[model samples]
Target chain A: MSDAPREIDALIEMMARLPGLGPRSARRAVLYLIQKRSVLMAPLAQAMADVARTVRECANCGNIGTSDLCAICSSEKRATGEICVVEDVADLWAMERAGAFRGRYHVLGGTLSALDAVGPEELRIPRLIVRIAEENVTEVILALNATVDGQTTAHYIAEALEGTGVRITSLAQGVPIGGELDYLDDGTIGAALKARKSF
Target chain B: MSDAPREIDALIEMMARLPGLGPRSARRAVLYLIQKRSVLMAPLAQAMADVARTVRECANCGNIGTSDLCAICSSEKRATGEICVVEDVADLWAMERAGAFRGRYHVLGGTLSALDAVGPEELRIPRLIVRIAEENVTEVILALNATVDGQTTAHYIAEALEGTGVRITSLAQGVPIGGELDYLDDGTIGAALKARKSF
Candidate 1:
């Protein structure tokens, strides 16, 4: 939809395929890149190329890193007895940004969606089960999302690890910080009330 | 803030500098690229590098191209006598998408903004005047935006081209296609009413 050269047009098309960008924003991004070729575009291109060539999925967990094991998986400081299971690497990053969890993570890649025919094998669920015994994990934390599919996957994993002698838990459900009580959904309000404790 | 490698972090930082993206969205985009490295990321990197190395501004029109002249300026079929001036290449692309203008374009790069210290000399106004004499241009159509700075630039260009014997015009103001009367600003409505033609 532009008179830009074929390489630029191809760049825009690939950029539009990114998760958040559309064709219009992709065009704008490409124009911005061309305008700042030396300071921004060239470095971005190099960084992407370097990452594409070097970055790899962690063999132990599913987190991304430069080697077979991700930083967290390889780090000796991270607790081996507790494992936080999340739906995606993005969620693992979010958890790390909070800096509260000191344990390693298990990336499920995606939640179970029968409609999409995604099963336990399709995800890293079998790998997670193997890690429990191999790593001598004592606690399994289900940090999955609250959506229907996320909850379904959590339940399936809990049932699968039922006889493994490992304690299973999930993230506490309640009103989020800075969230107004009036604006929260009824389900969140109900869950927050049910989980309320004495001061 | 992620445990991802430095290359991934650098890519996310560069992406966050884009117009519409924030750190969170940039992180998401980087993660998406990592996931589709083979299919999308590698090609996007190559395209960016190629465009960065080859793309250059058109000497006559300031439009981006692989050579000294942009496609519009190089095309023999485009009418040289009528030049449609725009504030940016994005606007030129917008005009091309409309496919109504059969004439050539002159990209001004930016509007004259006294507040930002941008003047005619900083833009392509001088080159445009030179083109009028060199190319024997007969008409100059100011297709600038309707903003105050855009109009200021247009008026300045019109005054500068005085006694050049070239027909000077601007894009007509009117209610936009599929626009609602209630949603339009008073100035637009007034202009549309004043420019109303005999139908």
Candidate 2:
């Protein structure tokens, strides 16, 4: 079969490896880019190159930014003595989109997965303990996922900070504000029932 | 909100403009690329740049490749005096993937549409006519979509080529192979039944 040039085919293969795209979708995306080369493809290529050159993990928190320190880490106003620990940078961005937290964050990179051989040192766990004492942080919120590995990581961190004198908290377990009880899984229903409180 | 650095954010925005991607998917893709910088992202960026620098439309058939004449147009075996006409290059690629047709192709760019004010001059209808005589093409296959405008364009092309003595044809309408009859639309069912021949 007559295919696109080698460079175009290579691009499609790389794109198909992305999180949400497959081979078919990547082919469509590449064709669209080729068709709109002047208006879209050229600009996208330039943008990706620019980001590849500048974006880096923050030295303090692991948030992605152009400089060594991310914007949150560099800002003096975000030093609220509260550290929200998340498992991934995507979670950090989700929390930021909510716009309710003024304190800084500590991205763990990933949860402690025994199957994957991920441990405390593999993430930023030791850094979190150090930050709690050095920054005089009073609260360390374990905002990890509800999965087994997430809980294990949170528990590990909590146990490790036994004498650190910092308050530990987690996201409340309950039905989402607009969630229907009928659609919730059994685990979510049980957690919501156990954490029920007075109105 | 704590968005990524400006360049990273720009990259995500540009990615979101692709055919099958939205903002959420684009953000996830960007994060994946950043995480796999050395293995996947850098190579993808370079591939896109290389394609943007070299890929061009085939002057003869409108297929995308690295030179003025695409690979299909430059080949000798494909000059079989038959031309398959399609509305877009993606369709042309689809035909190539099927590996059933060995003749050359003529990409019309798009079908003629009165509502969109697309006339004969806007597409490659005149070019197809010129190629028929110059290339000694004996047959012209109309592979435009089964839409109203597609049919209109086909009829227009057939009439325009009436005096040229080339056999005109089109893709047949039918229940797709492995397609369940219950899920097909009425128009498809009607066409399939009407076109049914000796089993």
Candidate 3:
């Protein structure tokens, strides 16, 4: 009950629903937006409206975009016969930021969670299967998280694509770059040791 | 380098400028908004636009409102001759949430800061001075923060109203209701001890 006007309060409430913001931070953000109404708030509102009106899921890859196909999916140069599978659009964005993958991506929306009753149809796994033959994919890389649900999803996809003849690989498990051995968890340390490469 | 649409990228950049949000969190928030576009994002955009178009500072007290005078200033019942002076609109809102104060508030916008070259003229101090006489204020309660700048501005206001013949008081300093003695800082413990009241 900050006594802000109804519109401002509503904006703060919606902002609080965002992934990283709580009620307190939402209030701070709304205050900041009001303080810079013309320079920031108005433009932000316009941007949001534009995105809401135009943004849609990529019909081919399930990535977010302004058109039926995402930029990666539409780009001819990205048809490298390789498809990187991720559990969410955020991971796709992370891979793009890394700039290590020039191929297209498949966004699973989420991992397979048996407790949540999420099955193969709930994800983009079926679409991923169709894509392998349609695009003549030579490799399918599973880049899902290391969580239990993520591993279950990876294994399910691997088995699904077993007869498709496309090479299946998972992201290498190892200590992260700049990671210290002493601070590494036992599981990661063991994995890194087992997968040790020649200098 | 997230490779999101240009509009999304722009929105993320603006969102990152908000208090308590960085680039990574901004990305997460944007993705969340996109996911809940109809239920949350559209409404949030509309709310922001409405606030931006209508919201303005209360000319009398520097509080944010949709009208020239804020709700408190417009309400005859709130003219109790006891004006609470706070450093910002957020503080005024905090007091409102506490629901302890019946009188209206005077938001100074910010405290006088030597390093920042902020003086009485830069804030709403002059307007506050004028309000004391015009509103028949009998008491001015300094409810600013306990920071050096807040205290400095409070003292400066007290000195400025020397001949106004109005009673000037400040909020009491003591341990917070749920505060623990062991975790309390040295300065706070000292202040609480000095301001201790009979049980």
Candidate 4:
């Protein structure tokens, strides 16, 4: 019996589920839509609906697009032989923003976690292997997050693919470039010291 | 010549125009959708499209809805004879989160801005006055931001409806409980003193 619309409530609920947006922010966003119905809300809604209908995962690389294959996978110009593996879409987005890699990506969806009972099957491990053989991929870059589960998953994948004649690597981990030594915990300092080589 | 789609580029451009989002974030968001087409992107797009088609401004209170009037404006239970006037819907939502008032709202869309040449006509000032008579409004609470423009707008409204005898009030400006008095800026301390009553 509240004054708000059912649709608005649904939208708010979905928005609340998003990272960083809580019930309060969701309500604020919904109210803003109410006021800017013509210029902002309507257009945003339309875009959302359109994307929901047309978007699909790339059959080859798990990338999203309006077709069977994503834009990156479909593009011949991309360095297809080099696959950058990431834990989630968010990480993939971060990589893209950096504009450092000119290759396609493989989204594992998540990492191996014994606590959560997640395994390689839960991830796209088998599919990733199949894609390597199918696409003639040579280099597999592990761009997963620097978390315990993420490292465990990467190690498992590396072990599984040994003797496949494919080169495997990972994103270098240490103290972030702009981080202050005083701010870092003892664990990070030890890891950085241990990992340090010629550099 | 780029691998990205023209539609996607256009979409990114539109997203860049959103508040709190820049070109970089927009690009990242679009790329994310492309990578998670089935799970996230597709659903988001469809929702947007559906909303765009069905959404419209409520003719009565300017809230977004699928019909001529918003659910809040049309509800019988919400006929409390009190209208909370706000500079924008963001403020309205904030008020709703507080859940103190059970009244309907009037979104002015923006504060009266002289520097930007915004006037009563630019905002929904006339519509608000008209609604007061039609809705039998008893109290008109001014919930504008504590800015010079906001105060100017409130004063103008007060003068305009001098004979109507609507109880005009504002949010109390004072030290928030648990906030240290020493930490307060000069303006806040002055306002607190000015607004201090028979305490």
- DockQ of each two-chain model: 0.86, 0.66, 0.88, 0.26
Best by TM-score: 1
Clashing pairs in 2: none
Give candidate 3's whole-model lDDT.
Answer: 0.92
- The C-alpha TM-scores of every prediction are 0.99, 0.95, 0.98, 0.76
Model 3 docking category: high
Native-referenced DockQ of model 2: 0.66
Q: Which ten residues in a row are the worst by lDDT in model 1 chain B?
A: B1-10
Task: Assess the local accuracy of residue A143 in candidate 4 as a C-alpha lDDT between 0 and 100.
Answer: 95
What is the C-alpha lDDT profile of model 2 across B1-199, one tens digit per residue? Answer: 2377778888899999997899999999999989887787777888888898899988888888999998888899896699999998888988988888899999998898878888998897888999999999999999989999889888999999999999999999999999999999999999999999998
Give per-residue lDDT, candidate 4, residue B149.
Answer: 86
Sliding window of 10 residues with minimal summed lDDT for model 4 chain A: A1-10
User: lDDT of each model, Cα atoms only?
Assistant: 0.93, 0.89, 0.92, 0.75
Residue A35's lDDT in candidate 1: 92
**Considering lDDT, which of the candidate structures 3 and 4 is the better prediction for this target?**
3
Question: Of the pair 2 and 3, which is ahead by DockQ?
Answer: 3
Candidates sorted on TM-score, descending:
1, 3, 2, 4
**For residues B1-199, what per-residue lDDT tens digits would candidate 4 score against the true structure?**
1234556656667656554456666666666555565776656555555565677767877666789987678778785688888886567667776788888988887878879899998788889889888878888888888888888998888787778877777778988889898999888999999988895
Tell me the tens digit of each residue's lDDT in model 3 across A1-199: 5788777788888888888889999999999888899999999999999999999999998999999988889998886599999999999999998989998899999988878889999898999999998999999999999988899999999999998999999999999999999999999999998999999
Model 1 misplaced stretches (Cα beyond 4 Å)? none
**B-chain TM-score for every candidate:** 0.98, 0.96, 0.97, 0.88
Q: Evaluated with DockQ, which candidate comes out highest?
A: 3
Residue-level lDDT of model 3, residues B38-126, one tens digit each, is 99889889998999999999998888999999888898778569999998888998999998999989998899998999999988888
Candidate 1, CAPRI quality class derived from DockQ: high
